[model samples]
Target: MDPTGNVGLLKCIYNIWKKPSKKAIIIYRWAKKMHDKNYKHIPIFLTNKLVVNYGSFISLNANIGRNLDFRHINGIVIGDGVTIANNVVIYQQVTLGGKNLGDFQKGNYPSIEDGVTIFAGAKIIGNITVGANSIVGANSVVINDVPANSVVAGIPAKVVKKLSY
Candidate 1:
């Protein structure tokens, strides 16, 4: 839907056709749906193809909400068990994954809340929740929970600025 409350299927189709990021998301969504239904082989193949083509890997087991904008799809990685809410924009080379193989084995993953914008090369790891409406800076490494409506930066992702809205 547009700002004018208008919805057009043709416009959406055009977007999917023109945007590689949109096409990648659509492929992932379909593959995830198939994986959820216990139809494994094709989904795995499709996801693998995405990885090979886009250098992005979004685990089918990950729970992602609506309107996820893959700002730039290259080198993006979203691991299994991660949860992302609506209206999130993720830039290139961003990783949403557990800290180690042990954490992955334990199904520990980061949960990103709504309206968050993760900049390029940022790594959000461990069992932490990034609060809603927060901005994660480029190349930042987040290992802890981020408070709502804040901007975080640096190696450990300290809250550098608090947002009013």
Candidate 2:
């Protein structure tokens, strides 16, 4: 796998694993048993890297989408109760956490919509909403709601360009 282009295989597996029509949770529970071609380097600590409802996750409270593909998931930590929509792509070392500056209270976790691509080393914190079909570039830190079909890059990820639907 090139790890850069057309990672639809993972998306397909995730879709199957997230569906209610099939044994999605059961398959997700056995995901770690199946080797991830994208994540070749499995950490020693993770015995079975399945995608259960937090049983086999480092921070498994996060809800992964139906069509999700992740590359190099080392050191990646998503916040509790975060919602990831369908067809979302995430790169290595991404951190999707809630804002913390002492006693903090937010409504819900981050909601990343369908067809969104979050690049490597990006940190999206806070209870924000990332619109559909958006692309978050490498090393960006997004703390606010992002518009749909926008390409955001750089620190604090500004809208570089609006994608064409």
> lDDT of each model, Cα atoms only?
0.94, 0.68
Q: Write the per-residue lDDT of candidate 1 for residues 58-137, one digit (tens) a residue.
A: 99989999999998999999999899999999999999999888676697899999999999999999999999999999
TM-score per candidate:
0.92, 0.64
Candidate 2: the clashing residue pairs are: none
lDDT tens readout by residue for model 2, 45-121: 24343333233233334567675766544556666657888988877678887776421245456789999999988
Candidate 2 regions exceeding 4 Å error are: 1-58, 101-105
Against the correct fold, how does model 1 do in TM-score?
A: 0.92
Q: Report how far residue 39 has shifted in candidate 1, in Å.
A: 0.5
Model 2 / residue 6 / CA error / Å: 27
